[model samples]
Target chain A: MRIADAGDPLMGQLVARYGAEEALAQVREGRLGPGFVAEIAARRGKPIDCERRLAAWRARLPYVDAEADLARGEELGARLVVPGDVEWPTQLDDLHHERPLGLWLHGSADLRFACLRSVSIVGSRAATPYGVHVAAELAAGLSEAGWTIVSGGAYGIDAAAHRGALAGVAETIAVLACGTDVAYPAGNHGLFEGMRARGLLVSECPPGVRPTRIRFLVRNRLIAALTRGTVVVEAAIRSGALSTAGHAVKLSRHVAAVPGPVTSGNSIGCHRLIRRAEAVCVTTTHEVIELMAAIGDDLSPEPRAPVLPRDRLDAESRSILEAVPSRSGAGPATIAVSAGVDLMTTLSHLGVLAAAGYVERTDHGWRLRRST
Target chain B: MRIADAGDPLMGQLVARYGAEEALAQVREGRLGPGFVAEIAARRGKPIDCERRLAAWRARLPYVDAEADLARGEELGARLVVPGDVEWPTQLDDLHHERPLGLWLHGSADLRFACLRSVSIVGSRAATPYGVHVAAELAAGLSEAGWTIVSGGAYGIDAAAHRGALAGVAETIAVLACGTDVAYPAGNHGLFEGMRARGLLVSECPPGVRPTRIRFLVRNRLIAALTRGTVVVEAAIRSGALSTAGHAVKLSRHVAAVPGPVTSGNSIGCHRLIRRAEAVCVTTTHEVIELMAAIGDDLSPEPRAPVLPRDRLDAESRSILEAVPSRSGAGPATIAVSAGVDLMTTLSHLGVLAAAGYVERTDHGWRLRRST
Candidate 1:
């Protein structure tokens, strides 16, 4: 592992020292970090607050110790994932200039693989029981179908979603506003540990930072960007969940909403989105998957997930893909047995792979595609 | 009123004798009625069944007496309104050839005036309390806003809507499947009387005819065509209420549906409509009025019925209109006192008059528009 002084000066170390906004300013100016502060000063149309921001960062510099924080993260069993790292989720690149400098991840699951075919399920912290029920069911169904569920790890609907994915014994990622190791809500500490054992707990902040109200809002974009589509379970008219849905729309990701009782204040935002034609109304988890699928053919409303492409496939999916023969092909059972994967997973993968063009369904079973 | 013999012989008497299909075939062949039988026989490439239908009609003609039916309707205290009558609702013209030959009306309210700025509220007869609540609330709100509410006077949701309008002291038309004189759902005989007392009970069939199951389905089109918009409060996937919404869509009228608990099977049709982007999802009465009001201009879901012109105004609205001055406007209280109407009704009529372009809102109160 590269220490602050040992490796590229333009890494998470600079971000931890200068703060993400200042670090982001440097990146926007095509200057890597503080080393190129003079170059940013020379650039035309640079933010007028640049000097003030730079001075503030300079003042805070002595107190910032990136190497020590990195050590702390390492001690806490967390890994730093910079832009070029294998675990970095590429969908965050949709944010471009606003993308985080790096992520601090906790848990064993590969973040990139987990998000390969993922959908975000999110809603209000003050969710109604109906909201909680729908969120959990949708997450569970999507997870069981081999698609990962992503959510901000908060109380209410988010907590329900995480439990649902785990209940299905499927992959999940809990993106947090606070440090992944810090239990901000306290009540969800057990859930945090559960997610760490199964899925991943992700955060943009360094180790030991606490969550603020603003941080939760700041964290919503990541949840939206990490997934192919987002299903808003339920939200009040001005719920923060709407901001996540807005982000997904700006990113050109399909946004779906579950309808609820109109009388319930929890459903107002969903109905508003639907009435405005801003989001498609979805009732079942199957419908959410249909919308999340890469293929847009078969315009009918019947729930059918499009196949996951090879590049979007998870590690196990790729391994399973290789197990299928090009000529005679293989029965799903044969493929599952050979790949050392479960029958449900093998079938799920084959359905998507056949849809994605990597394989074809043969009279016997499944075979590698002639084109690919 | 002219007996059917003195009027267009091509009207209901022939249809009643030979059936609508056979009579329509004769009409399509350029035959007016049995009087034009020779002309139909003379036509080349005429339908082979024409003569048989014509003979059947002629044989039944001896049993058909238009004068007696007219007398029967009159004796029932119902007025027979054929096409071209001042009391006829012209929006029904949207049906073209499928338009009813005449309407039997039982009420003191003018039919044309009652439907001028009307909305049809309909839903499943097997409505849940939630459906009934929403339908009634929506109907009452529309009624209080000076818009007439129209509905089929059946049990459940239909009964709720009619009663809701009456409770609001607003005009409502009950488009019946059977003769206006006969209440088909005997349970709602009291509701039918209430409608006749406060609004109108309308039927296309002559007096003494019974309601067939097919007749209810056939009558749904009239409800859709008679109003500026149709609000489907609640419906199952196969609810006949959807048929009315479908007819509204076909006729280019605004169609809206109320959102309900997604778990309820009763809301399936409404959810389907909203999900398919076929109907606007409305919750509040304010939203419904905003949809129905023309003054919203482009903000409305559609530009539908302008307010009925002053000449088409009901006797009370006309009196209220006269009470407002051309130069100096008057408050609703003053206008109501002068017009011998209640303040609430006066205010409601003024809102419509302002929307209709006959009146303008001034700093003083309400005034006749310079154009009108």
Candidate 2:
């Protein structure tokens, strides 16, 4: 928890080399390896006192109480899921050194199982009604199709997506920048309660830790890593939602954006992603599935036109039918001559066409069947 | 004019084999080549009497008067644009043997020159108001960008495109299924008149010929071939506009479709085209231009966000700016420690940041600039 916000490469390298327990012990004793002092100096472009840098870690050594933090989480019905826990999602490891040391999970659902087939729905907090509606509907449809929905529990599109998914059968996860027990926005307090009971509220921040601007940005990487893909519902050209999409791209996860009206300012980011070939343009659940699902598993059916009786006819039959008069009937021989077909073949086709209601027998001969 | 409606492979093959006049002479004199009967028989899957088929052509001999046809076209203020005419769009030859023998044109603008840099905008005739608005806006923008607009002279989207283009500085062409002298819809008479005065109305039919379903289908090929690309503004899944897109694809022309709300049935064809990779998804005039314009030419500037003073900062400067307090002031030494930079670098960047309106020196030290 102390190191959750420490994304520094130098600290990460030390933790990776000595392992967490030995690294923590070394940091407390101010003995962080033999060559680490020179490496930190090289990275910082200066050869200052390494002991001064280690002072910050020593200052918090007395307050580093793991038992108290775990008990506080247990009091809130949350659990600490470490790297080797059964409930820890393995996909987060794809972040390498940037991955959280531990995840604070608050929910009834098993996090790892739910995330095995999941997609994140994210967008701007100031989304228009069109975006909100689309996000909710898409989440509902995806949930109904048995896929989990993941998102940051912010306002606008995020809230709508969680609400929509909650109304469906599948679980939804909210990867928060603050502690799972804390509702930073306050407006989403009720929504957070609902998620705690039904799905999951996940965060790297320990109990009582509040969200900051930098935390929100860092939190986006978790949302992208936990899912099979990330869908940006509506975002401005410079929205933070684009940061999540960028994380998804870097993670090699499928990235898709929902297209809306060109006149809508909110759709510009989505359109830009599509135009740049950074994301696929997806409008429906089926299309999203087609992008994220295994190949040949969730292929959407081809767009089809309403079928007409005439569509079933073979080419030769269509030619013969064209020769049949619409209003007036003509003799078989006359129709054959106009159709440029042999009389016997034309006569056989006429009988078949008449039986199929494409034509009817008149006093003169066969004519097109008129709908009455 | 006599063979304008005869789009048969046999007739086209004969015209390619011999020149038009010589081919007509052979038909008139009943002197079709010695091997012609076998080829026709092989294509039709039967041996029929050749004389009976030639009789239809010979029967129209009295009505095939080139002088009268040319005079009628002149009376309507239209001109015959043969293959070699300077006003004929050579791009139409991309249709290969399916290309029309001649085009009847009525307008002030040069057809070939106008078509040199043009894009056709097509959609369903029963377009929604949203479709109509988008079509007009796209056409107007494209026209303002100096690209000529081409479309069928139908109601709804087609009429809106022409009207929008007319409102701009560029000419707009209406490629009609009927003769240039006839306005099939009657309701678009005013729109057609405006086009004839400022741009070209082109067709393969003679002066009095009316439009039929098949003629409309065949005419779409001309519109697709006469432009650099085709943009379907809005369309139903089975729309005739898709046929135009298909023709454009067959001719290897750039095909683009504007995206709309998924809630709209009218946008189905456009979305399907994009999903199938049959068309590039275009949302703005610049995007359309980017698709049709040559590489390294007319490329749209990347989507930009409202710039902030901080956006221009270098990495070290951004770090220093982040360390600067938003509400309270901090000394340069304090900020340097927070920003992990040297005191000299922080002091230099703080001065530059102050000049750029990103920070202001305060009574204590320095704080972020507050917009008034």
Candidate 3:
């Protein structure tokens, strides 16, 4: 069966099985199989089999002609990498329930390689001159320090990051929430084209798809996942750029924010982030590089340091320690319940463990020391 | 001898014995004795103390008419208070080397009472709207919290601080560099008059002494010495307000600064201070209050907490700790020499001490823990 025809049967089956939103989620997560369409159709009260639906859906497939679009992308010296492609970035998998169906990419460097050292630089679309200058300086510095710059292909801070990265030898990538072939803002057409040539332009949707607010929101995760860190240069309390920072932090990436004057409304979000300790305050290029160095590889699978020393720990202490995630550093009470231990024993064990350097108290709670 | 004549003879002899500047310094430090006139005449250089020269100098005594000035000050309901007066603020003793001769005071509040919880609010004469707003808000809040606002009687931030404090129940104090009867700017005549009526207008110079640039520079120390803390709201890199902050720091008073956008020249000095760790960044009245509470009484003679613990330290560690000031943290080599131990031993001791919680490693260096 043709690819589009094959996809249609699964689409309807998926819709029937999990409803529209769930079906879309399944497709985005690449979980929809060949029989998915049939199952969806059955669930939707449509008793059509996959083959019959395939023929009808094939008529609508012209709007999503991946083969023809690939040819056009090839002509532009770009490539369309799907979810299973070797060049596809696995970090993007962090989106889990909101993963993209495919990615349209244009660049010399593989998307996977870029994602390894990438950091998203985002801020206000209506940036002040100070914001723009800081953004450009940060982008240039990070790019020169071997970080791949990731940003939205929009005006203001995003465009400045792309421009700054282009000034450096390292590559930059612009991830659009819109179609690969379309630059949504139009004003950033030049910057988008430059990114396509010297860096990369990526999009989740197929060619000719229009941009939507929901798409933009969903797209933030992709940027976050494709980076080891995210730096918010300037943002108002409600700026959309903060969404990217949230996603980065959620994905366990380093989040750094630049502080501006307390009087500047544009810096309110950055200040709040720093104040709440959600993000570290960084002022210089070197500090950003240092934070990135400290975070290191995001894909490394090594288990985090233990919250307590295993050798010195007693049964109760061991049980409590085992109950807490090594990285989370949960409190004694949480660990006690998780370990099925009594609270008094847990507290005594914790105190002794802490005194013996077997565990450390963190801002959150008690945590095992990695070293004895 | 009449009070004027006696005082004049003493003043002339003081100028001859100690030189004008040194005599002023002595007077300011309250080191001059009751027999100050006779002592000055006795110590006067013979070359300049000829009988004829002594008569000539004594002839100039009528020109040193502070009592006449006191009479005029009384006419304005402003009292002249000397250093030994019961109502003198003991905190002014902090200006060991740069003390003021005497203070010309106006208003109903006792000078000592007004200085009890005083905090100087100073900044650039050219204040931004944001700066002015923040200064006014801080002044009003601090005044409401029972902090006597002290500031130079200048335009912009200073004027705003005075006005804000005056609007609250607590009276503010204006520490003029000029005479109490003299309004330097002339344009602030109404403000000066109001200050004399409700708030206190204080100056080091007796009546009829014209305001001079050098005197203003010297006067900043009085403001610093009289207050328990100093808040710099907004200042350019070279602002005179920074001089007050410097004096406050030197006097070991709590120095707080408001942070502004790095791009704003007006905030550069405050930011620099925060970055240097010389001043804590305070955003609100509550923060200032908390800082003051943390600082405690300024007049207390007891030393504050020892920056590092000594008894629990090893010989090497003790040497290193001794080398470092109690307030400032220590580095390795300095600790090594002070402990009379080799560098390697010092390092090892430091490692052990750090592990045992006898010392804490900070961003700058290792600091001795105040308690075991």
Candidate 4:
């Protein structure tokens, strides 16, 4: 519990290379371990102040209580999922040294299974009505397609996404920066409770930890890492949602952004991402699914013009149809002459065109079908 | 005037390969020797319909009068621009066999020069207000940046683009399906007059020719070929604007599409174009310029987060700044240990940080600068 620091890459590396227990024991005893020190220096890209780091760690030792932290989590009905736990999402290992030491999960849904086919939808906390509408619609559609929707637990776009997903068939997950038991926003307390009942509330922080500004930035990496791809519904040019997209880019996951009116300042970040080729411009839920699903498993069909009855005719038939009188009618001989085709060719095509509803037999001869 | 067909690929190729005079004599005499016949077959991708095609041309000969047509054009203040004319846009030659044999221009602006840095803005006649607003904004910006705007003189997006460009310093051209001297829509007569006074009106049709549905389809190619790129402002699923984009793509001209609310039916074709990778997603006029201008010459600067005072600090200085109290204050010795840096290093960085508006010295120690 004392060694879980997502922002401290050097500590994460030490815990990853050496066992968490050994790394903690070394920190506790203030021993001069050459191997651990060298590893830390390499990760830091410079020589580290081992003595100072150890001193800092020792200072926090008095407050560390692994058993008590677990008990506190149990009291809140949340469970701890370590690196090798069955419910642990292995995709997060893609973060390597930056991965959380463990995750605190509070909900009925299994974290690993729920995240197997998940996509993150994140955007501005002060989104416009257009942004909120797009986020919710996208989430609902994705959720109904049997893919879980993941998001932050804040208001605006995140809250809309969570609520939309809840309305669908699949479960939703919100990865918060605060502890699973603590709803930092307080305004989202009901949302958090609803998630706990039906979906999942996940965090790396221990039971009683409160979120800070830095924690939110660090938490963005987890949101990017746990999903197959991340979709930015709406964001300003400097929004924190962009940081999550940056993480997705670094992780080599697909990144997609929903476009809105250029007049909307909230859509600037999305348009910029698209302009820079950092993200794909996604308009509909089917397009999002196409990005998240396997190559050929969920391909979006090409958009096409609605087919007209005359569109089914061959080139010669079309020329003949055009020659047919719109007002009255024309005989095959006159139509053939006007169409520059032989009478026999015109006669045969007229029969086919008539059968296809492009032409009809009138008392005089042949004419274009009224609707066609 | 007899040889001014835009739809006849074989005729265009013949006029291009052999000079117009020679091609005309061959067609007029009904003696298209083997060479001309083979050329026509090659362009048509099949055996030539020599007898029938010749019959059709021979039939129209009685109605053509080259001298009288020129006199009529002179009366209307319209000039004919053939392939070798100095005012002709050679970019149209990229269409090869599909290129127009000649263009009729009726305006003060130079056809070739105005088209030198032009972009076509086209979309649905049924565009929503959002599309019109974006189109005008983009056009005005590009025009102010010294780009000529080209579009059909239609009711919606096209009119907006032309009007916006007219509002800027650069000239705007409208490529019409009908005669340059004739306003097909009638309602756009005033717009055509304004264009003739400041910009230009161009067409392949003769002085008094009227437009048909097929002529509009054929005219889209000219719009695409005349510019550095084409931007689709708004379009329904089967809109004519998409055909213009298609022509732009085939001509290797840059193609961009402005995005609108996904709920808008008029934006469906534009989103489809983006989704299909047929068009780049463009929001601002600067992004459109980035696509049209040579690489690195008119590049749009990458969007960035607003700079903060502490953002300039090096890692050590940032740590020192973080250690400084926000609400209260802390002494150098206390901050050094808290930040895991030596007292001297902390003191040196605190001085640099204070000078940069990040921190301020106080009786107790140092504190973060207000608003910094």
Candidate 5:
């Protein structure tokens, strides 16, 4: 038996209301598909029809109003992306029944494309200065090399990671435990704004939802599944970063840890992971790229001339490209001021230039693509 | 084809005069046994009989003055320990043809027994304060656990190791590049005297010899081979400590490294060793012992009641034992004054008490063995 496509849009709402997992398990186990909920509702008096469950589920629908949630999401410039959507990252399909009922995306970069070249860098919220520095530098390096940096986007190492990616002019993704509209920590509101401008803010929860402790752990699996690998920069033995690493390990994805002084309590988890051979000890961006690309010919995609043809780009893209330095990249704000374009227009043109391969990100910021 | 042990002991002096390494290869490769040297002397007219080499070898011997060198060693209260002697550490046999013909020693500890359970800790002569602290603390921990600490007798990390072992009252052997009596650095004069009273100061070079750059490197193999394992505390990428770790690896002995800040130059070699899987990463003395002891019931040698019988000890040993506090160990000088014995006598009795397991070294000083 297969889940029917017709029931999905409404069923998706019902599932979201009940939090997809338990309802999906029932639908799967009973071979109920397509019109299952309606069939159960119609066969209410039958013992096998889940009559009482259907009533309880229907009673909750008045509280949901799927169309209104969808309309509100649209109003916020966010979208409810269900299975089979073109923008959906097929990687999530690996989770099978546990896949989100739908993702709530609130930014411009294409989710699938951004994650095609991405890694998740996460660590402790109470990170030390050294940890923050390492996380930022490592994320910046990976970003400069064209990999999107994905993180939980709360504070400390996570905030540093997202900010570093933005500084590199590479798309950064924040897969939050709360709604895309809500920056849970509030401390990272500014960082969230920067990401939404040039990167993405994503979540499984719909609009207006708040984060909980269990939600963060559930969110970690999404962070791990969204990227090619996970790098734990600095984490105490009990840090939440370990949950993401654990998920990555279980999913058979690449897992690595940046080593720090054995004296630092913040580095205990990373050291322990390395000591037990659970994670590769990585100290540089190149090492991390190597770990993720071990079985591929991609080889961290060596620096080479840009792939986009010059004749195809628009005048604005050329202007933005000309404003960008060939090395030691410039930020969008600086580039916009230098290029005589407004920041929003300059950002849109820069995005086009990046996608067209006419420009690239570096640890510093955006730069023209490597010269032919 | 065995190396003929019957070669003249004076011929041994002649062999030693040129150093056995380069010239002995010809003697070994030729498969010549006993009387081969005499036959070479009788067949001196033949070109390949090594006539010129032997003449040069014999010429250097008059300068050696074997009897005088022996007497000077005796005057220094030293003894000659050849391979077959009961005092020779059998681990040195792993060096094969490269092994020293004999070792010169000036100390009280039994060379063989002291090394029966030992680890060599060595690193840069220009070690940072972190390196010194790590080296000293590591050595003390091992000493307290009843493992002898072996090291080179140079400045910096080496000096710190020996002093820490002495403080623990656990024997520490200093394998010198020059004659044991010379104390090449001279700065460690006091340290040498302390070790000589309770540990061992050893060298392959005979009396009247001074240290040279080549001698220290050749000496490193002996230090590496003398112990159950070698731990490089901190070293530059090209520091001589790596040579000892390499020798340990080649001998199939366990090799470990104490990790430190990667930003520090002193820890580069250790990090490199760990990166290349050439050594196990160890942060504590117990981990070192674990790597060295993979089999048998010696699993960290579980803490238990002292094995030494109290009734069997001699009167002086009893006095020294009684003088050693049960906690917060006492120094030999202080213990000597308290036990009513001379310093030298107190050290001798302490060594006996340590060997019998009635006492053990702690980072601070000698302490009564764990009771119950």
Candidate 6:
């Protein structure tokens, strides 16, 4: 299962069956269970012979040099956490379509705990002074409120967020698109090094991986998935910071956008987001804190309010309620499919439940009546 | 009756009753009815005799010498229009509580036409280049769409708005708080002169009156009343442009505010207005034009949609419809008072109307359904 054991016979079988890219895509898609990727390769007609692929994989190891890089990372006191590890954040499981294969972590803080109360602070690299000041204030306030800060290790708003968090006695996490050891933007070397020393620097890419535009966009998903919310301090209409907001929304995480002067292009994206109602308008740290608090317990499966008198329900009603996902706000058809019942049965039960105040229809869809 | 006939016996009567300051206040409030001072004086104690006050008023006449100044303005081809004159703008009638006494005018554009189709464009005097550019574009677009631009003849956004409007086929109007013969800022003399030539420069005070803080605020009412809408491009929270917006709202004119970056203090006032629902968010000339079109036929006594249906109605229904104002939305109690019927009768009719789909209840109150 470890990437280190390239010479193991099973590695050849896995690669031959799934092909390298397809296998990686499957793993990212969460469809390739542990030890099952080889089955997919056989189905694809590759019929990978484990022994031969393993030999070829070993022969190419010297040039790939992943083992040596892993050794170096471990020597530097960093831990490698793969997808199935206990410390892996479950919230990140939301990125089911584009999940990372593994993460390189260099820090002391528990990644899961860090993510539970974390918020990503992102903005344009060429941020104005007002943007920087507002970003720093937001970071400091969130950190002081017992939340972990998350950001890129670049200059401008990113560096400010990390610095603000450090100032508040709380550490931050820097998620880089490139390798953990390399700082792509040379000007941000000091900030990258500072984060590694006192906070955490994480990357899905192997050591020595160079930063690319595509990688930056891909990295946005990780930042969005690893936090409770994303706060965009300032961004031009075409700035990549909006990518993080887009991913945050897809993952159903809270996205808070700051407002700026309509005259400034830097704030155009944020204003557009507010106007479209894709993000809540946040002018101060207090609003950000309130948004976080509202969604704070959303990740858990614990009843948001309480089980709405389900004990007195009939079998059909109980089945329909049970079929509803804790947070997905399921409709009657989806509930029926999940409950293995016909649509009519589900609808009838839902109608009764609704009439009895056991469930309610909301703008979001339908859900058990929390007020009940 | 006329200011020039100082030797008339009515002059003594005016001085005996009104004095100078009281008369000016009454004039500013638009309550100086014709011959009011003469009638009041005639009603007061014994035979009215005011030789001393008349002499003082005549001496003070030099300071209020609008006629002498008018000769200079006339030499410049400008005319003055006092309140109640045939050519006076009817829109100014909206300033019931803070009306101006008169307007000094320059240019051939009809005052009434300009007022009916005008939109006041105001912003910070120390506007940024972006603000100035947006103001110009907005003004030009509005003018091209047949809107007459109205603004204070100052620097930054105001100057840009006038210039942009002049560039288009539709001319603009400048309302100055200073005398029509004087440019208050001094630096804008060129703009002032250009406006006088191609557009119009108007003032409430007489030709020689100097600009003061009080006059500037009072002058805002003219800009607000003379326009169908007001667009605030940029303003700090306490900027005087907001006063114009207040007047626009009071005059029942459409208030459209442009959104800006929240980080910029210049946009904070506009943002607050939008948030409070005092102004609709507008980003382009089309939106402004649409808003104006939506508020068409401004003088129609019944501009609002009727709330109730008349088809298949009885005496109670007719009574209810009669009780409702053609313009103002009314509740049961107010309807009862206006209909001279009991509260229960009004409520009963409202219930029938609601059931018949003639009226709709809303969170604010109630409104007539658009269709019967």
| DockQ rank order | 4, 2, 1, 6, 5, 3
Top DockQ: which candidate number? 4
Per-residue lDDT tens digits for candidate 4, residues A68-105, read 99999999999999999999999988998888888899
**Per-residue lDDT over A248-302 for candidate 6, one digit per residue giving the tens place of the 0 to 100 score:** 9999989988876555677777866765668876766666777777655433221
Local error of candidate 2 at residue A180 (angstroms): 1.6
Evaluate all candidate structures by whole-model CA lDDT and list the values in order.
0.76, 0.84, 0.70, 0.85, 0.75, 0.70
lDDT of 3 by residue, A1-372 (tens): 112211233443344457655654444444555565555556669764444333333333333455677787777666777667899888766765455556788766678887787788999899888889888888997888788899997888898988899878788999887676776889988887777776788887666656655567768888888888899988887777899999988989899888776667788778667645678766667667767775553222321223533545564466555555556578776666545455666788778777877678899887767774
Poorest 10 consecutive residues by lDDT, candidate 3 chain B: B1-10
User: Candidate 1, chain A: TM-score?
Assistant: 0.70
Measured against the native two-chain assembly using Cα atoms, what DockQ does each of the candidate structures obtain, in the order listed? 0.10, 0.36, 0.04, 0.43, 0.05, 0.06
Highest lDDT, which number? 4
lDDT of 2 by residue, A300-345 (tens): 7766899877778885587678768888889987666555555777
Model 5 chain A, TM-score vs. native = 0.67
Clashes of 6: 13
* Backbone steric clashes in candidate 4, count: 0
Model 1, TM vs. native: 0.71
- Any idea what lDDT model 3 has? 0.70
C-alpha lDDT (0 to 100) for residue B324 of candidate 6: 54
Pairs that collide in candidate 4 are none
Per-residue lDDT for B1-372 in model 4, tens only?
454346577667667777778878887887765677876778668997776666655555666788988999999999998888899899988998888888899989999999999999999998899988999999999999999999999999999999899888899999998888776789988889989998999988888877756678899999999999999999999889999999999999999999888878899998888877899988888889989998888987666678875566676676667668887889897777656566667788888888777899888779988877
> If you assessed candidate 6 against the hidden native complex, which CAPRI class would it receive?
incorrect
RMSD of 5: 25.7
Alpha-carbon shift of residue B221 in model 3 (angstroms): 3.7
